[model samples]
Target: MEQDLGIALPLDYKELLTRFPGGVFRRIEIDSPVANEKAWTKYKRALDELLEILGDEDLEYLDKVDYTPC
Candidate 1:
C-alpha cells in the first residue's frame, strides 16, 4: 500500500485502524480511499451494501464524496 501511494502512512494510523477497522469519530467517513487496499475494499463494499439495503436516497451526498485514488 505504501508502495502504491508513494508514501508511508503513519504508524499511529495503521495501529488505530487495525484496532478499530470500522468507522471514524462519530461514524463520519473521510470519503477518500486510504493508502490501504483492504480498507478501500471494505469501504466500497459497505457503500454497496448501504445502497442495496437503503436505496439511492442514502447516497445523496455521493457527489461530495471524493474518489481521487491515493
Candidate 2:
C-alpha cells in the first residue's frame, strides 16, 4: 500500500490494522475486509453529501457544517 500511495504509512496505523481489523477506535472506523456494512452505508452517504455541499458555490455550507453525526 505504501508503495502504491508513494508515501510511508505510520507504524501505529500498521499495528492498528493488524490488531483491530474491522473495528472502531476513537470514534473512527478502520477499513478492513469485514467492515460494518450499516456504518459504512451511512458514512458513504454523509461523505457524498459533504462533497456535494463543498462543490456548491452558493450553499454557504462551510459555516453551517455540523460534525455531530461523525
Candidate 3:
C-alpha cells in the first residue's frame, strides 16, 4: 500500500493500528518544516480528520496502542 502511494510507511505505524485499527492515510512525520504556515495548518487539519474518523469507527482498538504522541 505504501508502495502504491510512492511513500514508505514506518514499521511502527502498525502501532497506530493497535489503537485505531481502521488505519491512517497520507501523513507522515518529515524532517523539514512545511513550506508555509498554511501548509502546516492543512496538514494538522488532515490529521485531525483522520483521528476523528478513527474515533468514530472504534475507540477500543486504540487501547491496544503501546505508545502515542505526548
Candidate 4:
C-alpha cells in the first residue's frame, strides 16, 4: 500500500500490517500529525472546493503542509 502510494511508511508499521492485516489491535489509536481517513477526505474535498473558489494559490498553500492525499 505504501509502495502504491509512493510513500515510505515505517518498517515497524509495515511489519504490523503484515502480521495483523486487519490492524495492530482492535481499537488502537494513532496519535500523529498525519490526518486520519475522515479528516483527510474532508480536507481534500474542502481543498478541491477552495481551489475552485480561490484558485491555484490555495492548492499551493495546502501543498506546503506535505500531506499525502488519500
lDDT of each: 0.60, 0.61, 0.52, 0.52
**TM-score list, all predictions:** 0.36, 0.38, 0.35, 0.30
Q: Of 2 and 4, which scores higher on lDDT? A: 2
Q: Identify the runs in model 1 with alpha carbons over 4 angstroms from their true place.
A: 24-27, 30-70
- The 10 consecutive residues of candidate 1 with the worst lDDT sum are 61-70
Task: Give the Cα error of residue 70 in candidate 1, in Å.
Answer: 12
Clashes of 2: 0
Per-residue error (Å), model 4, residue 40: 16
Residue 56's lDDT within candidate 3 is 59
Q: Could you report the Cα RMSD, in angstroms, for every candidate shown? A: 9.1, 8.0, 13.5, 9.4
Over 4 Å off in model 3, which ranges? 1-33, 57-70
Which structure is stronger by lDDT: 1 or 4?
Answer: 1
Off by over 4 Å in 2: 1-34, 59-70
Candidate 2 has its poorest 10 consecutive residues by lDDT at 61-70
Alpha-carbon error at 61 in model 3, in Å? Answer: 8.8
Scored by TM-score, the top model is 2
